[model samples]
Target chain A: MIDGGYQGKILRVNLTDHVVKEEALREDWAKRYIGGRGYGTRIICDEVDPKVDPLAPENKVVIATGPLDGTTAPSSGRVMVITKGPLNGTIACSNAGGYFGPMLKRTGYDMIILEGKSSEPVYLWINKGKVEFRDAKHLWGKLVNESDQLMREETHLEAETMEIGPAGEKMSMIANVMFNGHRASGRTGVGAVVGSKNLKGIVVRGNLGVTVADHDKFAEAVRATREILAQNPVASGGLPLYGTAVLVNIINSTGSMPVRNAQDAYLPEADKISGETLRTRNLVRNEGCSDCSIACGRVTAIKEGKYKGEHGGGPEWESIWSLGAMCGNSDLDAVTMANYLCDRYGLDTISAGSTVACAMELYEKGYMPAKDAPFPLRFGDADAVVESIRAMGEQKDEFGRLLAQGSYRLAEHYGHPELSMSVKKQEFPAYDPRGIKGIGLEYATSNRGACHVRGYTIAAEILSPGLDRLAYEGKAAVTKFLQDLTAALDSTGTCLFTTFGLQAKDLAQLYSAATGFDCDDKEFLKIGERIWNMEKLFNLKSGLTGKDDTLPPRILNEPIPSGPSKGEIEELDKMLGEYYSLRGWGKDSVPTKDRLKDLGLEDLS
Target chain B: MKVLVLEPAKCTGCRACMDACSFEKSGVFNPLDSRVNVITFHEDLMFVPTVCSQCETPYCAQVCPTAALVRNTTTGLVDFLKEKCIGCKQCIVACPWGSIRINHLGKEIIKCDHCSGDPACVKVCKAEALTYVEVEDVVASKQQGVAQTYRRIAAEMVKGVNP
Candidate 1:
């Protein structure tokens, strides 16, 4: 089953016919796309109809795992869920890391592709070599935790379940299928596709373990990775202790922690909602993904207060920004509770909080009366934040429905679309691109709308790659390289955080060993470029263009007003030109024929 | 009498015990198939590991239909002999604490042997939950736990519980 240590077969579950078929491995596609988000986008764009309504039953959800998956490789417990997002209305490929990917790998399938809507609410169970769809009508409209509980009861505590909550079942655009309690596939709203299919959840359990083709060599590579990571203080020392919350004070001090929905470039409440605060005050424990040593995933709980018993899928940096500063809510307990609600309801905290923020601005501006709206939905209202999150879970009432659609559509409905901090219908994150130019280019180019994790540029523009600081001139070159590197990492199903310690050459070396393909650094980088261009081509074919590559009006028009990044505006026109030129794209930002030919993609398009 | 001395505060929930037992018995890494189960009541962020006490009157070994399981004389470890085992899961049902499990997928019965003398799980546990302390020391640990609880209550007092 493994030539290069892989399951060799991808499972296709046609929910419409209740068909669970095992398909042969596509060696060529695996070679070109690698896996995870890379293969996800390629398969979706080529196989599924672009015109299929994102929320409709016809749309397909192809869950992909990479070649490195199930190995003792760090963070190989990652998987990608790809479909048309109701939030962005584009190619939504969201990646998550936990025990699920490894379990699926043990179940003897490289990937699981869910196609067509089922007759009724049902969940697919994969037990070692067995696969089946069982009735889930009784479990419909449950939260992610509730679904997990029900499935575990039915499967007798043997299965690890991945399920969406009521928000997904209701087809809420910002929904995510939470993995366990602390980790999530927290972006681009793939949960809506899961909901649309009437597939409530997927539970997998297996006793089988993977065999690395060359176990001795694989062991060496894993050890080398640990050695590299051990030196990078960020991954080994800092992240394990503080998690990604390590960025809070730094991003704030640099004026990159976007506050009050990007109107302010820094959060004054930086100390309250920071990673340090989380560690000292709220952190209950920390855990790792399958076989990972860096256990950065935080388990936090609010203790001894009104928000007592309030816990988290732990508030990540983006969650801290979106639900914390973006809404002007500083109460740490409330922020933790909001984070909990997002995971419980299986909603994306970024889109949910920013959507509510957009409405808050509108309400403040007298665009809508508070009486007509749900709560006094104003900025900095803690009660309102909690209530709005509850309403999102319920998926009832007019205001909740609007917020469920995410910020882009919510603002557009009020004829104040410019107020929405978004690109491609997904809301922008904490980094105000106007303050930092490279992130602006990255947001416009990211396949899944307004995503930062897709290609984070804060490394070069703010926190510098080699711990160097603040270089703007050569950032275009740096961002381009990192973004492609990120694309490659996602394809390989490795955590993007690994890039902090692991060099491209190491990744290339590991990739060759894992896939049984001799891919040099150039070959790897080409695959990354190919995925990026393929995603761009998917967007283009799905009716997006260079015009769409433009940032939100506020980001383009406004300066930081006052901060370290004050007087700075996004040099978008200049950066986009150079980026497109380097990417071998036309003036319209579509990949040129020459670029496709060069990347061995001529046969593809 | 022998007993498990568990320190709740020190537990990190690495589940190394499950790995060690499954590896020796099934020759695979499976937490589900392990005998000494860690009942992690995660809402409390607490790990309450349920293991065999190796009681003076062993209920499971006493009631085994095939007499497949028995308490060792020298070490008092509750060991299961696969050759003697009929795959009848009577001991699993007879045990009150649920520290026994059959292979969930393979349908083969399993239980903890505590590694004869030097227990592998106890040695491997980063948390030190499974200690191979002297049989007499178990009483002293229980006395220490009670004394600590009394100190905690005394520290918290302005008033005692009303009669």
Candidate 2:
């Protein structure tokens, strides 16, 4: 029997058969892989076959929370969704924050695994230990927020719901699952997989309370962490005031903000859409997730104009880069509107915006005629960006259909794959690698595709203020450590922003106090390393090789036209060799047998 | 003597206050057990804290047949005696704010008592949204807020601007 921390139940549901059952959580797995993304990746790797289509019945979607979820620990209201990515055909693990994670954990379950496709639309109602299958045919094809509201009204319970909008129902490769109507488990098309199962949403409500292993010790650790966060400039001052968009000006100042579809590393109009501008022009207030002390979530509003009274969660730094700089649109109002549409329609903004950017480049290059689009699409046209996003979400036109295929396909459709600034078919975020060496290597090797959150070594390479932003040496080791630590942190059911002030040691203490396990910083990092290796194994089994661990041609070959790091191309080959060695992998980037044995993952690779 | 006053504009909707209250009374971390509830209007971008205002004439106390609810003289808060409660749930319906709730065992009513003048929720609120302040000071501060807003609006009008 599980003692504390974990709720000790793993719920499995087969939508095809409408069969639901619970399996005892494996404590050994908890000790080895921890939870959240770690547990989700491991479970999905074991159950889903490498050859199965991500949108097929064989594909499994596992949603897992860690032992620290539902506790008093800061930012513990988060969950991980793991499945085969329909976008890039890679092992995908997406994390989202809101109330859904804690509410799920309070139902006495560590994870919920959904398998098989249903013949018709359905929704799952989970109350404590019982799981009910409710018909959602009427709720099908609704917007994410409308679906959430309808589900709550039908259930007559104050339940936390995660729903996918028409984008997912149409199976757009970049469609995401919206949590609590706003937060998204965005990236890799996890929502498309759920949509393929004909499951519209999952509603959960629980009253059971979580009890910590050592209450006093947990309290002390939590108290100390809050104080530490309060002292950190990024966690307290910057994040609370500007949210994640705080990085817009800083990264731009460092000449690392990717602009105009990677044509430039510096956007001259950056200040027009920067976080400071948002604070004065759009932000209504700062919001937070469950138990979060650092309220970094921004609730914004478009005060006046064509989009007056329009409001939503945010246009984060990535959104600003994608919808603003990347598309050559400097209008914050248009960016904010696009962000809200993406959220409501369950679309991944990075992919959607990058696809539009790619289309813009194609149109400018005369490959795709401007007349073919529903509107006159051009760079710096905020109206075009807004209309294009709406058209894509609705799949209304030929241009919309092409753009829905994401940047890789959209760029290739016009015979210019190089225009798509992506790795492994997933769009790159705001950071330009020419100015940040660690981020480039991290992007190349990230199992889930080109993603900043996977291994945000930029935290040290750029945002640290005093550290070397362009150093290639020792970056391999640092990126490897960060990738592993990020994997561990993602599994802990806490927001990664906590790393700004608290390190692995602090997390270890909190986890130990909550779970009654004495894990140290070194051990925690080792667990993280093991989880990363496990994901690597899954990717390898799915036919990805070391050669796949490379950046896009444009990013690797082109030098920054003009920036602080002008004339610098990514030195990827120099770091990839060192990274492989540091990770204890062969030159082919496959984990060695001995390395697998050490991590108790002998049967993995 | 003081009462819990809420400035909802400053709330982040973190729910730390609920956790603190739940831990104080139930010895566990659960929002369902917390007396103070936070409701968020996502579309409007607002957060409102729901707690007993401790009205001069508490409807919960007046509606009670067995007199289970009574005003505590020291804290100037309504206190519930579970032993005297009949579980009729009149207090639940009578509370306009829906602040009172049934305990986990469903045998008694749970409501805020200001934690005997040192509310756990107020103590944990880092945003200073929930403050324990004197009643007169609360009224004066609200008046000051209105005056400040009026002055800002007048200044904006003088400058030929509208927000």
Candidate 2 — which pairs collide? none
Candidate closest to the true structure, highest DockQ: 2
Candidate 2 regions exceeding 4 Å error are A369-372, B65-67, B143-163
> Which candidate gets the maximum lDDT versus the true structure?
2
lDDT of 2 at B117: 78
Q: What is candidate 1's lDDT per residue for A296-369, written digit by digit as tens?
A: 77778888778887665577878877888889888778888888888888888888888878888888888766
True contacts kept of 1: 0.06
- In model 1 chain A, which range of ten residues has the least summed lDDT? A463-472
Interface RMSD (C-alpha) of each candidate? 4.2, 1.5
Model 2 agreement with the true structure over B118-156: per-residue lDDT tens digits = 898886676788999998998999899899999999999
lDDT at residue A442 of model 2 (Cα atoms): 87
How many backbone clashes are present in model 1? 0
- Candidate 2 residue A39 Cα shift, in angstroms, is 1.0
Q: In model 2, what is the error at residue A49, expressed in angstroms?
A: 0.7
Q: Taking chain A of candidate 2, what TM-score results?
A: 0.98
